[model samples]
Target: MEDSSEPFAILPADMFGQVTFIGGVSVEPLAAVGIIDEALTLVNDRLTEFAASPSFETDMQTVFGESVDVDLGRTIIDALSLGEGLPEITVVPAEKMNGIDGGFDSLTGGVYLADTSIAPNSVIGREPTQSPNLADVL
Candidate 1:
C-alpha cells in the first residue's frame, strides 16, 4: 500500500482559487487561479517536450529511481515554480510599506525576515512530543 502520510499531489488544486494574503495584500481571486492554471500548462508542455527526446525517459528513471509520470512530474514542477513565484507576487505591493520585506527561500522552504526576530524558545501550549501508547493509557 502506498503510504497515506506521503503527499500524492505536488500542489493542492483547490489552492488555485483560495484567498492568499501577504502583509495584508491580496491577489485577485480569479487572477490567482488563472496564473496557477497557466503555470501548470506551461510546465506540462515543457515536460512533454522533454519526454519527446529519445533518452529523456531513461535518464529520468535512472536519476530519480523510478519512471516519471509526465502528468505528475508536470504538476510537481508547476507546484515548485508557483511556490517560488508566490513571494515575489505577495511582496510587490508590500514593498512600499515601511519595515516590511519578504522573499522565498527555496532551500529552507519558507520566507525569511530581515528586521524582525521571533521570540526565542517560545511554547504556545503544553503537549506531549509523542503519542501515548494505547496499552499504557488503558
Candidate 2:
C-alpha cells in the first residue's frame, strides 16, 4: 500500500485535517480542524444580519393582532428588548494615573477635567445598550 499521508506530513498543525476520498481521488478539508470555530463565526454573522434586519413585531401583529397577551409572544418581546443588539454610544472615561495626590480634584478623574465636580469612571469596553425605542438611560 502507498503512504498517502506523506504529502501532509510537512503541513503545520493548523493545516492538518481529516482526509477523505472523492471518486477514487483524495480530498482534504484543511479547515475541518476548526469546524466548531467556523460554525460560531457563521452563527455570529447570522445573528448580526438578523439584528440589522427589521423587527418581527409586525409579523406578530399580522398573526395575533397588535396586542400580545401574557404568553410566548410576550416573553419573546421582553427578551427582544435586551438592547437593540447594536453598538451603543459609548463615553469612555479617562483613566487616572497611579500616584498619591490630596488635591481637591482627586474625585474627578484626578483633575483631568477642569470640572472637579464631575464623577470619575472608567471601563474596559463600550457600555451595554437598550432598545432604541426605549429611553436613552445608558
Candidate 3:
C-alpha cells in the first residue's frame, strides 16, 4: 500500500476542506477519499492489466457510484504505477506419467494385480470343497 499521506495530496484540497468543515451535513468528500484509498490499495495488490486500461476511470466511477467524483479514478491510476503493459505468461506442459517398465499399458487403464500365495499364518484360509450344512452348525 502507498503512503496514506500520498492520497491526501492527490485529492482536491477544496473538496477535502469542505468535508472537514464543522456542522457540514454532507460526507461525500470523505466517502470519496475512502473509496480512492481502497481502490489504490486493491490495484497495488492485484497488479492486474485492468489498471492500465483506458476505461479504468469509467469502471471506477461505476464501482464507486455515479455520485463519486472523477478525481478518485485518476488518483487510483497514479497510485497503481502500471508500466507499458502486463508481462506475458508462459505455461509449461506437464510431464507424462511413466508406468511400469517406463511405459503405460493402454488396456485395463494401466492397473495390474499382484500375485499372492497362501501361508499357514495367513488369516484368510482356503475355501472348503464341500458345502457345510447349516442345520449341523446351528
Candidate 4:
C-alpha cells in the first residue's frame, strides 16, 4: 500500500493554466492526461497537421534544465510540429529571479528560457512551481 503519511495531492493549474508536481512526485495522472488531451485537441483544432504517433506517449522532460539551449529548442519545435500552441509560452529565467537553496544546484545562475524551451517540448502538462505568483499566467 502507499504510505499514508506520504504527502500526496493534485495541484490544479493556476489562473494561467499551469500545474506542477509537489512533495517529490510526478504530476498527477488525471490532471496531466487532461491537460495533454486539451493541448493535443487544440493542436488538431488549430494546426490540422499533427497526429499522435503510435509510440507517442506524454512524459515529463526537463525544461530550463541547463543552459536554456538546444534540447529546449528542439522540444518546442517538436511540440509545435504536433500542432499545439503551448498555453504559456514564456516564463522568467528561474535561476535569475531566485537563487539556489543548495539541493538542486543545476539551476544556479539566472538564464532566459523561452517557450520553445519551457513548454510542451520539454514536457507535457504543467511544471512544478514554488509559487503561482512566479509563473506568467497565460
* lDDT winner: 1
lDDT of 4 by residue, 1-138 (tens): 232323244333322233332233233334443544454444434332322332122211233444445444556656655544434221222343244211222354222222122333333344565322112221
Q: Write the per-residue lDDT of candidate 1 for residues 1-138, one digit (tens) a residue.
A: 232323222223332322233332333434433444454445445655665667775767786767567556545655554443332222223333354443445774434222121112111221467332211111
Q: Please provide, for model 3 over 8-78, each residue's C-alpha lDDT reduced to its tens digit, 9 standing for 90 to 100.
A: 22232221111121121122334434433343334444444565677866887788887776675555544
Model 2 pairs in collision: none
- Write down the worst ten-residue block by lDDT for model 1: 115-124
Local lDDT at 68 for model 1:
62
Arrange candidates by lDDT, descending.
1, 4, 3, 2
Stretches of candidate 3 exceeding 4 Å from the true structure: 1-48, 80-138
Reference-based TM-score of each model: 0.32, 0.21, 0.22, 0.21
Model 2 regions lying over 4 Å from their true place: 1-33, 59-138
Report lDDT (CA) for all predictions: 0.38, 0.28, 0.31, 0.34
For candidate 2, write residues 21-120 as lDDT tens digits. 1121122223322331232234344444543446655655677787755256545433434422212111111122133211233243211111111121
Deviating ranges (above 4 Å) for candidate 4 = 1-26, 49-138
Query: How many Å off is the CA of 67 in candidate 2?
Result: 7.8
